[model samples]
Target: MAFSLFILFLIIGVIEIYAFQAVKTFTKVKWVRLCYVIISLMSIVFIVYQFTRFDRSVGQTPMFMITVGLMLLVLIPKLLITSVLILEDGLRLIVGSRNYFNNYDKEASFLPERRRFISKVALGIAAVPFLSLIYGMTVGKYNYKVLRHTLFFDDLPDAFDGFKITQISDIHSGSFDNPEKISYAVDLINEQESDLLLFTGDIVNTNATEMHPWIDTFKKIKNHEFGKYSILGNHDYGEYVEWKSEELKNKNFEDIKDLHRQIDFKLLLNENTKLKKGNDEIALVGVENWGVKFKKVGDLNKASENLKKEDFKILMSHDPSHWDAEINTHEKDFHLTLSGHTHGFQFGIEIPGVIKWSPVEYVYKQWAGLYVNMERYLYVNRGFGFHAYPGRVGIMPEITVLELKKRKKVV
Candidate 1:
C-alpha cells in the first residue's frame, strides 16, 4: 500500500512539474508563476488530507463530493497540459540527438528551450475540459433532457398501443445538494404526462436517510394512470459502506425500499404486475439489481412467474448487463427492458444519430440509449441524478419517454 501510494504521488508530482513548466513558459511574471505553484500544491494537499479522513462507514458525504469535484477540476487540465509538454519533450530529444550527431550549431544548447506557442496551445486545449467540468458541476448536472422513442412491436397488445412510459433511473439522492434543481426535474417528469412512470434504481448513494429531505419533493411526481413502479439498483443494498452491524445494514436496506413508497412508487423485488387496458394486458416485470460486476440478486425466473413467452412484457432491471447476461436469451422474450446503472460513466461524447460514445461503452455493450437484439429492446437511461463525480459532462441527465406501437404486418 505504501509503495503504491508512493508511486501515485511520484507520478502526480511529475505531472505537476510539467504542467507548471507550461505556465512558466507561457509567462515570465514571478507572482503569476508563484500563484500557480501555490494553488497546485494546496489542491494536492487538501485532496490527500480529505481522502485520508474519509470514513467508509459514512460514505459519499457532501464534503466528499466537493473533494472529488475539486480533484477532477484541478487534475484534468494539468494532465492535459502535462501530456502536451511530454510530447514536445520527446520531439526535442529526437531533434537534439540528431543535431549533436551531425555537429550542426556547435554553439547551440543540447536541447532547444520549450516553446511559448506550445505552452499557449496546451493551455488553450486544456481550457475546454476545465470550463466544461465547471459547467457540468454548476449547470450540466441539472440539464435534464427528455428523450422520446417510439418502439413498434408486433407482440404489443392492441389496447396498449400508443402507451407511453416515462423512465428515470440512478437517482443517487444522497449526492444531491440542490433542491431547486431536483424540484425542476420532478416538474419535468410531471410535464411528460406519460401513462406510466418507472424508476430503475440507485435511489440513495448508500444510506436511505440521504433521501429523507427529498421525499416530499419527489412525491410531487403526480401518480400515473397505469402506475409508478421501481426496482433497486446495486447501491440501494447499502453494501458500499461499512455498517456497525448486520442489523444496521439490513435496516438501511429496508429503509431504502420504503423510500420508493414515500415517493408513491411501487417497489418491485423479483416481482411482476400486469397493467391492463381494455381487455388486453401487458406484464411489467421488475427485478432487483443484477450486474456482471456488482450485486446479483435479480431472479428473472421468479419475476416472470406465470407469464408466458407469448405475453408482451416490459422489464425493469437496474443494470443493463442483466439484459446481456440473461434477459435477451431467455425464452420468455421480454419485449422491452429499461435500465440506467451506467450513467454513461457521467462523462463522454454523445451526438444523436451521428455518434454516441463514452468510456463506459468499453465496459457495458449497452451503456446508454436504445439497443435491440432478436426483436427484444433495451433502453438505458443515462441517469436522473449524479454520483461520485458530483456532476455530468457531455452526457446529460435523462428522462426517457418510450411509446409502444404495434408493428404493421405485410402480406
Candidate 2:
C-alpha cells in the first residue's frame, strides 16, 4: 500500500510539473507566470499534506471538505490537461515521423500554431471536468431523486398484490455533514408511505459511533404499516477500521445492531419473517453482509430454514453479487431480492433505458436498478448517502419506491 501510494503521488507530481510548464508557456506576463507556478506548487504540497494526514473520523468536517475540494480543483484539471497533451503529442509524433521519412533534404520546422492551439484547447477542455467535479461536490451530491417502479409477479401473494416497499441503502452516516438535508430525506421516504420500508445496510462508514449523531434525525422516518426491515451491508461489519482489541470491535458491531433497534428497524441477520394480510402470506428473508470479495457470512439455507419451496420470497442481501452467486441458483426460487453495495460507484450516467455506465459495472454485475431473470428478480438501490469520494457525480442519492403488483393470468 505504501509503495502504491508513493507511485501515485510520483505520477501526480510529474503531471503537475508538466501542467505548470504549460501555464508558463501560455502566460506571457512574468508576474502571472511566477504566481501560477507558486500556486501550483503550493497546491501540490497541500494535497500531499492533507491526504497523508487525513483522518476518516473527521471525514465530513469543514476542514476535510476544503482539503478535498482544493485537491480536486488542482488535480482534476492537471490530469485532464495531461490527457489532452498526450493525445496531441501522439498525433504530432506520427505526423513528424512521416514527414522526416519523406523529405531527407528538406528542413522541417515545428508548427508553432499547432503547439499554441493544442495548449489552448487542452486548457479549455481541462476546465470542463474541473467545473463538473465542482458541481458534483456541491449540488449534485445531495440531489435526491425518487425512482418509482411497479413490479408484477405471478407468484406474488394476493395480500401483497398492491403492496408498496420503500428501499434506501448505503447510508454512510459518518459522511453526512448536514442534519437538515437528512431530515428532509427522511420526510421524502415517509411521503411514499409504503407498506414495507427496507434499508439494505451500510448505516455507518466504519465505526458504530458514526451513527450516534444522526440517530435522532433518522428516527423521524416512519416505519409505515408493516414496519421497517433492514439487512447488514459489508461496511456494517466494522472491519475497515483499526480497533485496539477484538472486544472493542465486537462492541462496535453490537452497538450498530442496537442502533437499528433504536431507529425502530427490525435488524434481520440470516432470518426470515412472514408478512401476512388476512390468509395470504409472503416470506421476507434477510441475510447478513454477504459479498463476493467481502465477508460471506450470509447463510441462505439458514435464513430459509423454515421457508417452503413454493413460498413467495423476497430476499434482502446487501451485495448484489449474492443474488447471482447463491440466491438465483437456490432450489427455492427467490422471487425478489434487494441489494445496494456498489452505490453505482457513487458515479455514473443513468438515462433510464438510454445509457447506464459506471466503472463499478466491471466489478459488480448487478450494480443498480432492477435486474430480472426467469422468475427471480433483484433491485439494487443507488444508496442514501456518500462514502469514500465524499460526493456523488451523475449518480445522486436515491430513494427507491417499489410498488408490488400481482400479474394476471390470460384465459
Candidate 3:
C-alpha cells in the first residue's frame, strides 16, 4: 500500500508540475504564478497528511472533507489539461515527422515550440470541468431530485393498481455537512405524498453513530399510508471499520439496526412481509446486504419462503448486482426489485433518453435508473446522500417515486 501511494503521489506531482509550467507561460504576473505553485504543492501535501492520519473506524471528519475538496480542485483541472496536452502532442509528433521527412534535412531540429494558441485552447477547455466540479461540490451535492416512474405489471393485484412507493437509498448520513439541507430532503419526500416509503440500504457510512446527528431530521419523514421499510446495505454492517473487539463490532451492528426502529422504519433482514389492500395482497421481500463482491448474507429463497408463485412481489436488495446474479434467475419471479448501492457513481452525464453515461457503468451493470427483463423490473435509485467525496456532480441526490399499475388486458 505504501509503495502504491508513493507511485501515485509521484505521478500527480509530475502532472502538477506540467500544469504549473503551462500556467506560468499563460500568466504575466510573477506573484500570481508563484501563488499558484504554492497552492498546488500545499494541496498535495495536505492530502498526503490527511490520509496518513486517517482512521477507518472513525469514518469521515471535517479534515477529511477539506482534504478531499482540495484534492479534487487540483486534480480535476490538471487531468483535463493533461488530456488536451496529450492529444496536441500526438498531433505534433505526426506533423513534425512529416515536415522532417519532406524537407530531408538531417541536421534540422525535429521538435519545435508548441503553439501559444494550442496552450490557450488547452487551458480554455480545462476550465469547463474545473468550474463544473467546483459547482458540484458547493451546490450539486445537496440538490435533491425526485424521479417519478409508473411501472405496469400484469401480476399486480387489483387493489394495488395505483399504489405509490417513494424509494430512497444509500443515505450515507455520515457525509452530510448541513442539517438544514437534509431536513429539506426529508420534506421533499413528504411532498410527494406517496402511499409507501422504502429505503434500500446504506443508512450510514461506517458506524451507527453517524445517524445520531440526523435522527431528528430523518424522523420527520411523513408517515406513509401503508408504512416505511428498509433493507441493509453493504456499508451498514460496520465491516469497513477496525473494531477493538468482536463484541464491540456486534454491538455496533445491533445499534445500527435499532437506529432504523428509532426512525420508525421496519428493518427487514432476510425476511418477507405482506402489504394488504382490502382482500388482495402483495409480498414485499427484503434481504440483507448481498453483492457479487460484497457481503452475501441475503437469502432470496428464505425471503420468499411462504409466498405463492402468482403473488405480486417486490424485493428490496442493496446492490443492483443481486438482481442479475440471483433475483432475475430465481425460480420465483420478483415483479419489482429496488437497489441504490452505486450512487450513480456520484458523477455522470444523465440527459434522460439522449444519453446516460457514468464511469461506474463499467463496474456495475445496473448502476442507476430502471431496467426490465422477462416481466421483472429493477429500479436503481441514485442515492439520497453523498458518501466519500461529500459532494455530487452530474448525478445529484435522488428521491425515486414509483407508482404501481396493473396492466389492463385487451378485449
Who wins the lDDT comparison? 1
Q: Is candidate 1 or candidate 2 better by TM-score?
A: 1
Error of 1 at 187 (Å): 0.9
lDDT-based ranking: 1, 3, 2
201-228 per-residue lDDT for model 3 (tens digits): 9998888998999999989997898899
Over the full model, what C-alpha lDDT does candidate 3 score relative to the true structure? 0.88
Per-residue error for 110 in candidate 3, Å, reads: 4.2
Q: What is the lDDT of every predicted structure here?
A: 0.94, 0.85, 0.88
Candidate 3: C-alpha RMSD to true structure equals 1.8
Give the Cα-based TM-score of candidate 2 against the true structure: 0.92
Model 3 pairs in collision = none
Off by over 4 Å in 2: 1-6, 54-72, 98-114
For all predicted structures, in order, the TM-scores are 0.99, 0.92, 0.95
What is candidate 2's lDDT per residue for 31-147, written digit by digit as tens?
988888788888878867877787643334445667777887788789888887777778877777777777743565542224766788788888886777788777777889999
User: Which stretches of model 3 miss by more than 4 angstroms?
Assistant: 1-6, 94-110
Superposed Cα deviation of residue 54, candidate 2 (Å): 4.2
lDDT of 1 at 143: 90
- lDDT comparison, 2 vs 3, better candidate: 3
Q: Which ten residues in a row have the lowest lDDT in candidate 1?
A: 350-359
